[model samples]
Target: MGEHWIDVLPVFSDYWINGEVFTCQVDPTAQAQVSPWWQVPQRLIDQLLKTDPGPVIAQALQQLQETRADLYGRFSPALLEMKIRHLLVQSHGQREGLMARIVTTLESE
Candidate 1:
């Protein structure tokens, strides 16, 4: 079968920026081998940070947990949990960094 491709752009809070198109190749039989198609833009991150981050973080955590459950028996659950915990910690640090940047920007004005 021929490969199928779809283009996508990241959107934040109903706003979308132009000029960025991510092409994702879809292979019906090779779901596990498919790679991520796009990078999260810095502007999108900034816009998300400007709003309440709780729902976003909660959604991401739910997805991570679901993925871990889906991949059960393929790897050690303890190891996967450890990695997920680390990622959550990193997300917290990212929030702090974003807040710091906002404060700095405000102070400079």
Candidate 2:
């Protein structure tokens, strides 16, 4: 189910960050074989964008899933954490230092 990254946004086509890695962060410039299937909801996005520190993944993802299963979908919190870590490591473009640390947080036991 995983393969090389796609560097170009297909014209007039639908794509998803969960299914593809955009190497440039905003666009594609290189390649990685995986994508994180979940993203922070708006509330969490705002929290994560803060400079000091982001919300704890162990706590946050669970809350998101439990409260809004219809939006984020049902996913394993631990696996989601691992997926995000893999994506960030493979294609973070050296600009997501805060996020790297944030995602590296331990998953819930």
Best by TM-score: 1
Q: Which stretches of candidate 2 lie over 4 Å from their true place?
A: 1-68, 93-109
Model 1: per-residue Cα lDDT over 23-107, one tens digit each = 4445556434334665679887876655655544455445545643444334454554444444445665364443334333333
Instruction: Report lDDT (Cα) of residue 76, candidate 2.
Output: 64
Cα lDDT of model 2 by residue, 1-109, tens digit = 2333333333223455878634433425434435453444866555453432223444445554665554335356667666544544455322245343433442331
Determine the C-alpha RMSD for candidate 1 after optimal superposition of all C-alphas.
16.2
Assess every candidate by TM-score: 0.26, 0.24
Q: Which stretches of candidate 1 lie over 4 Å from their true place?
A: 1-5, 9-33, 56-93, 96-109
Model 1 / residue 39 / CA error / Å: 1.5
Predicted structure 1: lDDT: 0.45
